[model samples]
Target: MVHEPRSQTGLSRNSDTEEIVALAELDPESWSAILAPRLAYFAAVARAEHVTRAAHQLQAPQSTVSRALVRLERDLGVDLFARHGRTVSLTAAGRTFLATVERALGEVERAAESVRADADPESGKVAFGFLHTMGSETVPSLIREFRADHPRVRFTLVQNYGEWMLEHLRSGELDLCLTSPVPDAPDLVARRLDEQRLRLVVPEDHRLATRKRIRLAEAADETFIMLEPGYGLRRITDDLCAEAGFRPRIAFEGEEAETLRGLVAVGLGVALLPPPAVPRKGVVELTVTGQRAVREIGVAWLKDHPDTPPVAAFKRFLLTRKGRLLSFSPAGV
Candidate 1:
């Protein structure tokens, strides 16, 4: 003989309700066992691949790393890497698992930092990450002002490319970053600091260098000196060239805007660049026809850090000088 159990919402409480609550609190052992070891292993793998330069970054012996990785694989009940010669590459499962681990660890770190920040708002160290190009201009000024205003604040600044900096910012490794506007991340809040138009930097004797309004296609055959791919300027230049129905003939690849400009000055190749405040002595700046490539550069930080004193003061300075900064934009700007 069997009886129907009453639902929790029904008049009487059932034995099943207490059992369900107990299971919710303690019975998910299999899921927990799978997740914790996997995340810890994923962190080791991420440090091995993404953050470190050499195969062993922390002075750990190569055998130690290999043994640790093997232990992780054993604990996870699957292989996470495939080795070819001296190199180790992630397996498909490894890639998928790594993303989840990175995200979870990031959230944990942010939550921990939030508690620490709440406790000591003014005394802890702060890091400012800046894009390489912008760091040449805006960073020095801001750093000087910040150091003067907050003598007690410990500060560290890193110069890196845009995409890499964005990843570090999202991970809470960076307190704030100065970079051009990227497609906004949900957790990010950007305050516009300045805007500038792109200009053509070419050798002084080049034909297009003399023109006030030359079409993009006109320079299509010219050797283009560009930053390596993954750079924001390279992406913009490639898009602009594609839109103009041609591709650029890249002759030299560089990482620095000023270096790219210097290459153009020395007859290496022409480059499309944002009008930076630094002057290139022999390079000519030309106006592109029907195009004023513009980008807005700004300060970005986690939205929850709105009242951070240094962040607030930096925003105030940028906003106050934004008008004067506009004047430094390219000629057409």
Candidate 2:
């Protein structure tokens, strides 16, 4: 007969010791595949210290529980329980293993509960995105109206310009977005919710300030402050200027409309912009006449994306508000 090596503790370094060493070296995925399903069974038996009692607690047959425990011990290559008459006590290895098992089970339970809470119909979360211009009033009004009926629904709101929000929608970061010029793309579903007439904003003392309406061509020679390129408003402004027969002389490129309005207020330059939520003191907003000087505001989402209950409900509400989405009138309109 071949004899295996023995440790100083007099325990033989046999196949069990080899197996235990191999298990300890396993990668997380391999360890999970081997031990995950058996962890609950081992924990229950360890807790009750009685196989029959543990089986009853687990609502499983005693024989099945016994077989599972035996297989678990065999797979682990360690005797976890010291068996007595109809009862048991944990070996040193079982006690050490139980601590980590309990924590893992707790983390798994918490993760499951978190997802359940997010999926709850009455109180789920919606990842909503919109333009910076809408943040001050339009979005707040919409959310307030929505919450009056769905008091428990939650929203994760993002404010950015159009194309950025559209990218977020495509990447699954956003559930839905309100954008302008109404994106025409194969991967997106877009709807024109409303149209906001663009206005020519000028300093109070500028030549065109007193005019109620003017042809866009009249501003051909004037310096313009525009939203930086890649912004939806910037694209719309460029298109409108092109139709009016001249490329604008851009003096400053900015991110926010309010900032551009501030520049216009100080006589830096004129701008083609949407109506401010609150009219500024030093800028006169005139209607742009003769051409289609309006931006079509729309809601967009991924064509194939499936929405959670709260997201779906909010989308339905948005669709119902078509043509009336931007109900508030701009200054001087």
Candidate 3:
């Protein structure tokens, strides 16, 4: 027989307090199921500040909108709106709740849009990653040819070394990647697209610059500017050097192949690199003889991950270009 205190809006203050606490404890599924629809109606009404106008905007009957608002306030244990004839104004509580509700609704709308975009065949997005060496020409040509038929498809391109691209693929940040040495991981699916010949690049004035080809062992005494460890190209360089019966004298370590090539051009050191997209001045590229000095370039993705339409289409297009992936002119080489 205890009488609860009442608020100015005629709501039972004690019961409203208990209800607010209980609402906070609801499980995610229960909260979402019970409150999502009510929140939409509340937002519509809050924006218009009039039930009749909000109902028209929502294309719902005015009675339905009023009932939803009443139910929402009752469930939350507070009066969210102050009624004055046919017009309504937000209570302080309503104003606070509206800010959070709007953000949640916006996130939900964006999520819907993202999923719909992924499912679209003609205009979906693909998150693709690739080696830095391929960015200048190889990737551009591949994308241009693929987009000939998929003109509306969008791409999110990332250029990084092989191992970093693989990490992004595992984390779901990348849908597909073109990487070197054709990674042999259990969690990844890979196909050898082509092999790029590695060349020994030195300054134009260096002793071996005039030779078109030489055994890798010939540069054993030369200071080498190599990519830092963890890059697939660096690993290939190390292994190839080891096979040639000499460890390269390390002069400098860098991130990008082109940057290392630039260092070689400046006479800092020599480096083993892929053929440049355009012939660079001040450096002579010599083919490595007596040892297989080529890195396998392959397309890779998570083994069991499902691809969106655009990603799947691009993957298929890439597989079709198996031996011809690079498309570099012999003159450029």
TM-score of each candidate structure, all chains considered together: 0.58, 0.80, 0.80
Cα deviation of 35, candidate 2, in Å: 4.4
Pairs of colliding residues, candidate 3: none
Span of 10 residues, lowest total lDDT, candidate 1: 6-15
lDDT of 1 by residue, 35-154 (tens): 564465446655565212332455555444444465455445576766544455678877877788788888888999975763354554567787777665566766566567666655
Instruction: Estimate every model's Cα lDDT from 0 to 1.
Output: 0.67, 0.87, 0.88
lDDT measured at residue 181 in model 3 versus the true structure, 0 to 100: 76
State which candidate has the highest TM-score: 2
True lDDT of residue 296, candidate 2: 88
- Encode model 2's per-residue lDDT on 64-122: one tens digit a residue: 67766765776777888787767888899989989998999889889999878877789
**Lowest-lDDT window of 10 residues in candidate 2?**
6-15
For model 2, state the Cα shift of residue 65 in Å: 5.6
| Cα distance off (Å), candidate 1, residue 94 | 42
Report the candidate with higher lDDT, 1 versus 3: 3
